[model samples]
Target: MRNPQRLNVPIQLDRDLPEPLHDQLAAQLRRAIARGQLAGRMPSTRTLAGVLGISRGVALAAYEVLLAEGRITGRHGSGTYVSGTGSAPVGAGSLPVRASDVVVDLRSDRPSTQAFPLAAWRAAWRRASHQAPPVEEPPPAGLPALRAAVAAYLRESRGLVLDGHEVVVTAGYADALALILRARHGAGRALIALEDPAPPALRHALARLGTVLPLPTDASGARPDLVPAGCDVVAVLPERGVLGARMPTERRRALAAWARESGGLVLEPAFDGLFNPSLTPRPSVLALGDADSTAMVGSFCDLLTPTLRLSFAVVPRRPAGAVEEGLHGQPSVTCQLAVADLLASGCVARRAERLSVLYGAKRAFVRQVLGAYPDTRLLGGDTGAAAALLLPAAVRAESVVGALLARRVRVADLAAFCHESGVRENGIAFSYGHLDAGLLSGALHALTGTLDDHRLPRRSAA
Candidate 1:
């Protein structure tokens, strides 16, 4: 069999220019490689020179430049090949490269989608698609049916006695936060109070628009005393921490009272605990006598898939108009209808019940595994998708996280969540929602081994 001629790359150079011929040639080849035209094996320097009507020395020099820069590889007997730097050729049937060799994933932000009711959801979607709305544009507050369904769901499950009018639909958590900020402050720097170990995404969202005054937290959650005066908004999770710490009842009241006194608004997330059976429903800030000064955010991400991007905010009557205006576009009509069907037909509740059982068992398994290490303290499991594993003071949380990542198992470092530099809590947050029982077991085994390896040396030295 005869090999085809290797001459796909189209190179043009000017001999009249001040630039060296080799330099111009190399530059052309560089462009070709970047455009993916120069993938796979390249013609030999002698052959390339002959084809391009250039001197063999110039071609060789250009090839040397590419070689030194690690752009191409030269085999002793075989011709030069495009190095791994270039993308695979189009229609070459190259398999998609895996991002990592991750055998188990325990990343905290992810929710469980393994047991999603795909059949029922598809049925709902089909039904929604068939029933087209008379109007193409959805109402800014969402479809009337979805808004009513959301209000009813919250009222029944969370004990909020709110009407459907209070429910404002949003694209997601980020969109909800953006709307809240815009409606309240309207393009000014607002100092917001945030829990020390708040969700990184929330902190990141507020970073540009506001100055975050860190509220230090203990076992019972964010300390009310530490909430600085003059901040306009204080963000917290309803009766819980971002990673599942149960806030004491007194503390919750105290925080609400602080908001009342300071004339600051409270933004409580009721996002993650919908399916947590262990947690008894407490009075939300809206119900606990701070309804006027609080805005509660929740999402279907915990109930369904994150990519669905459906969320709602219980906005007070005062800023209701502005918040509605800020929500410029409506959520997808089909999604709103499907969710409405799920909520109305009680499909969501049934799924939540099953998830409640699964997550409870998974949480217990995690606690049991972490219990083997006496120095490690389990902080929160009352609600939410993840639990915090507080480590001894000396163990660097980032180092252990790095070790686990090296073994292709990922977990969140508790330190990364803290907004304040002075706070030095060390730990990992394990999200068990996404992983199945078998993978969760394997992840725990690897996590325990990594923790042990890091701990033994410090113990011996001390």
Candidate 2:
């Protein structure tokens, strides 16, 4: 009667229960086996009794009950085997039902999925599918033609000087970052220093494999000095610093220096960098002749629709081969094909240009609405895509959020971006990218009314 070596149950039995220990153990084991935990194996009655500190007679009695119930079958020489009843049935649904459906979804980060260029995408996909040779092989680090097109697009539109060979297509910015991190530093020893108030998705991804050091950020952006000296990598949002403004050139140079000095890697996420119509495009850290120390990453999803999951990373010249090898080792071919189709079709580039103009107008409209409410203080002044509004200190952001939700107006609280525990100032971050003029106007009106009802003071005109 040896104990079942294969069985791994998570429950801890309570000896003080009024129910007999053997009955309790039997009931728990039955449920565990029924739930597929004790599949294909049976523990010996003697071993079970020894482990549970129960009498051998009690263990034999429990085994008799289980045997009668057809939970296990004893082979002649070998120990008992778990019967068919011991394992749970497969293919069961276990999803929860929602009580009330959400009407407005403002929490998403990308443009509406319905607005995706489906017709153009389908035509391009069909064209690619047909032209693609049967028994397809993975594209040379993503379709060569697409790479060339991206190179040309970046050079002309983004002020980046890149060759097709330098660009490697990725599923999205998140995937690109993961691949680059994996390549430069093996899955182990990859420590990424992230901004304290960073995108939750990116933070979660980095946290899964690497040590994450949360560096504090302010209006200027992530302070490079705060980054731990020994960190192997650093992730920075160049376009939208901590408070959502462009990181100054001086700070960029300092970060470059940090990477160079420490033999560290820098992942520069150029989010919404192309949308800035006012400022000259800042050179990417990877493109700053420090390709050995930095990787430039960007995504088309924000400019186009989220369905177009095309992103690219320009690795340092020396590490390009290692990065490509690491990428191929990982499973990401489907995403590469989809991105290639989108890029080759020229739909994403065209849509991005159109969206630039549309979002520009929307940004202007939001500004006008902010202007109407003289008390509101606009943070991240002249930022192209998203704007932050600071409400009076007296107004409760949670109350304002609830009121806006009641009016079917969706917006995000600035406090959600805070990393530390304390009473944060009242503010809201508004993205004009997906909003239309009417919706933007309505939301502004609701926000103004909410502020007025709370009797919050307005910022005085400078």
Candidate 3:
């Protein structure tokens, strides 16, 4: 056993100082622990009292107070020691196991089904199913009526006027992007410039096709003024995922100008725009510049349902041929016709409006819950169902995410979306889609408890 004097905690008790002896000792001990002076095994109550010239009961009372607060623990015949104070530095390996019996998931990427227009969608599908079955092959571009409806809806909603001929229906965003790249791939080697922190799957797809150069984006989702001079295609997300920020108008014009000057193509994926209905909608890059320079890609998976697997790209007259050459097969005629009816009957527009209102409220509530904790900031909840939470500097996002998962609250770390290394924002994206109030509250509580567990000071570096 260590000597009583070597206990090292400075305890100066003044009986005439009005404050009780035990309270004063406990306060000082708390300070010592906070300052890393007191750790591991502490001197026994008898030894501490003898060293400080205090009664044994007074020393015991002080130790009992610290024990009650979980600052110290006593093991039978082993003496008391500092407890509930983490001594190991936070890291990926030290994180909790990601399995639990509790059930609450906050992983970002889940879609909100609360506001789905089931009645309208069923009615549209019924109408499409009732139509006389045609034995003709699906058109190379898409069903004529569907293309026309998409064009009309785009004009009315996003202010992007395009002929039905410009619309090419595809399976989804991936299919649409692949078609664009194939059409834009001219004689020489194909090089593409993409924004950093983009969709991981899309980046992987681009890497498989050709060389991809990453362009950094600013706080508002605008790319830097300069890009590689020789790239044939420049793909941008108007509503960037993870970050949940949008590109500025001036930046949009710059991108269009680059595409026009370099004789390249700008593929703008307006996935978020599908559900986000604004009074003054932001015109797509296709509308901002000449049709030859830009193509707009959209997906129905954002609004209706992901399983529907319907998407389209609006291209210029010249590249319309490229889409035809690249596309292997057409989308399902029945699904296309159903969506067409939705667009033509204004059901899509009305549904988008209702979704905007419904999700807007849910997003606000989620932000409120996440914002209640100190040292946390929310990044993207503008147009998507997910929001990125910036954590405290000392906190590692993966560790917290893992901790939450161990308690059955699943969330994804933002670093998972990056293409390169050394990115250290320490954020996790939480998706509040389709989560009811009770589930959300429970998840938040679990997250809170996990964070609380990490509040103790970790072991210092060697």
Q: Tens digit of lDDT per residue, candidate 1, span 259-368?
A: 78877788887555546766566677666646567777788877776777798877775534455666757678988899999999888888788777767777778877
Winning candidate number (lDDT): 1
lDDT of 1 at 219: 71
Query: TM-scores across all candidates?
Result: 0.74, 0.68, 0.72
For model 2, the superposed segments whose C-alpha errors exceed 4 Å read: 1-102, 112-122, 163-165, 270-274, 318-321, 324-347, 372-376, 420-426, 458-462
Q: Largest TM-score belongs to which candidate?
A: 1
Off by over 4 Å in 3: 1-103, 163-165, 186-189, 273-280, 319-322, 421-424, 456-462
Q: Report the lDDT tens digits of candidate 2 across residue range 160-237.
A: 775422777776666777677777776675877887566666777777758777777777877888887689988888
Model 3: how far residue 365 lies from native, Å: 1.3
Encode model 3's per-residue lDDT on 294-412: one tens digit a residue: 88778876666667788887877763345567776777788889999999988878767766766676677777656666677777766656777788878898899889887777887
> What overall lDDT goes with each candidate model?
0.73, 0.64, 0.70
Give the Cα error of residue 256 in candidate 3, in Å: 1.2
Candidate 3, residue 54: how far the Cα is off, in Å? 72
Show the lowest summed lDDT stretch of 10 residues, model 2: 94-103
Evaluate model 1: give its TM-score. 0.74
Instruction: Flag the better candidate by lDDT, 1 or 2.
Output: 1
